[model samples]
Target: MINNRYDFIMLFDVENGNPNGDPDAGNTPRIDAESGYGYITDVCLKRKIRNYVELVKEGEKGYRILIKADRALNSKFDEAYEAENLKKGQKGKNTDDVNKAREYMCKNYFDVRAFGAVMSTGDNPCGIVRGPVQINFSRSISPINIQDVTITRQARTTGDRMETGSTEMGKKSIIPYALYRAEGYVSAALANKVTDLSEGDLELLWTAIINMFEEDHSAARGKMCMRKLIVFKHDNVLGNCPSHILFDKIKVKEVSAPPRCFSDYSITIDADLPSGVELIEKI
Candidate 1:
């Protein structure tokens, strides 16, 4: 098995406003100060949702692969998996579920992808140009390799007189742990290649990593519109991944510009998301 560490990072921004807070709370979600209703039609909302789903799917897979690799490194787990009486698919699902939870926690804690939109309250909301929300996602898997690690075991077998051979023939010998290490190398290199990335090379990279979490199309859409994003160490696929190993250690950036200025803009949407997801108006 290929034993190598995989590190990846993705970053980008998208437009925000509308759907950020409780619109009924005397506060209208405005972009640049233009209250009332945002131009994002229902069609647009659907489109965004679809995009998010695709991104989540892709991100989740990448996360799963990493988790699997980690499990393979555990001698006890690997032994149980390679045991003669074990089933064919022992470690796959268990590892995947655990990784899924982990990814979800990270996304929620870091707010890697913006969900609802936030609007400006002051004056001239529609006057200021709101920039995209930046997102960054990073991951690193080290010591990934297949090695011949030894494990010691005590003898537990007895032989019958009929088994005429060496005295140690039927007896169990103290054998060392010897198994093939299936170290997994999953980063943007493998993630993006399998994913259908949509805008902002940086955003696309982040979306790909988000796919390592839950299957939420909205997250991907958010990345496209400069709203939500994903960041990682580097782009191993095209050598764009980041050089840092502590991606999770970084902080997620918030929108610093005005909201109203972030008017409707065209963005490349990933075609893999749900079908009916279209851009929508905030009503």
Candidate 2:
């Protein structure tokens, strides 16, 4: 079950596909062996979405999902900034004194190296670990249509050739897959105080809301990843209801692929064990 406050998460395990491909080369979400899957990130985000809508049964009526895509950092900062200032000099008070400031002088918070991340592409694109946006009841008070959001992480540019030199080496911005951990919290209004919506009610409410977008099995699987979910809650929060947010960091304890194997404990004593059995346990 989820609460009043929630955070929506989205990750793109892009192996080798670009929904927005380069126009020069071609205009399409390019698909290649390198293209990664969106399952992990999508599922992590959907979990929280499911929780939030479910927790707020009535709130679901006005529920709407909005995605504020990544905003770019301005580039023209290398130039100088000029400002008028009156200075007391040996000659006299001079108002014509204009001082030149470095382009970045105005803003210390701007990440000077961030723009470079946006430029790298190809097999390795910019990795977006951007913080999730928080939405509360008051902000989502108005009734709106519920829309499923599929954030397609695409490469904006091909990475520099290996010969670009060490200085040109940029971190791969495009990640085929990223490790994500899902966590969440609920508000006090729904937790401490009594509300018409119960945990069961919230779950039921979300079941319908989520199903609207999860119609196709393949789609749901593809979008929701492995169909795993994790949840949490917070108390005395600004909002009165429980909030939900999806987590992407779920990890399998162990993973094995390929050829199957049979244990030595086969039905017949002489029956041979299958190949590839690292070790076998017996009851």
Candidate 3:
């Protein structure tokens, strides 16, 4: 089980792609209204991490993802209650039954262990778990330009086409390039509350963070890579210092022009760390 406090800064870049699009804005890239910097939500990054873990650890014991596509979440809660034979309409067993079900889910699901979940909904009310790991929204260093393009399909998909040479039109949005940074923290104390977060899981988390974009390519996201990962491990479980102070040590210089690639800027870590903290570069 984890015993130390951990904080990390993750750097990544995308080229000719939409790292995360805002569906509310015609599927364009999300941006900060004031600063004009590109925005990638924490949920988007977490989703990719979940996807990567699901891919590599498929069918492994206690490695299921809690929030998956097209799957009924209520069914999962029912399964948890069923594991302990807690029946529907059963009363007075909620206290023990909920705790058991919550523990079972935390032990079984990676996302639930790492990101927490609200399992009190539906038939069985599994108590909520506060996950140990928490990540911030990623924002690009510079403002990005959105490239919008329209393309046409020669043949229409509908069979009720009246014209002989009918074509369907579609729009695609992309950013020329952008480099983003996101921060996170992990609490050992919180992790041990429900699930046993082993060192193997820590390693797997890093692996997923680095390789998350490799298999996640499509027409929208063209090329993406994990540029750097800097971690600060505190000797104390409660943490040696505030996260903002540790994150301030790692500095990235401004680029000459609009950054089109990772090499455009330089990254440095001037870590005069405290007595009990250790820095680890995992990328």
lDDT per model vs. reference:
0.27, 0.26, 0.87
Better of 1 and 2 by lDDT: 1
**Which scores higher on TM-score, 1 or 3?**
3
lDDT by residue (135-195, candidate 3, tens digit) is 9999888888899888887878677773656887778899998999999999888887566
RMSD versus native structure for model 3: 1.6
Tens digits of per-residue lDDT for model 2 on 196-245? 23354444433433342243333222232212222322232344222321
Q: Which residue runs of candidate 3 sit more than 4 Å off their true CA positions?
A: 90-93, 160-166
Off by over 4 Å in 1: 17-207, 210-283
Ranking by lDDT: 3, 1, 2
Given candidate 1, what's the lDDT at residue 59?
55
Error at 36, model 2, angstroms: 11
Supply candidate 2's per-residue lDDT for 22: 26
Q: Which is the leading candidate under TM-score?
A: 3
Rank order by TM-score, top first?
A: 3, 2, 1
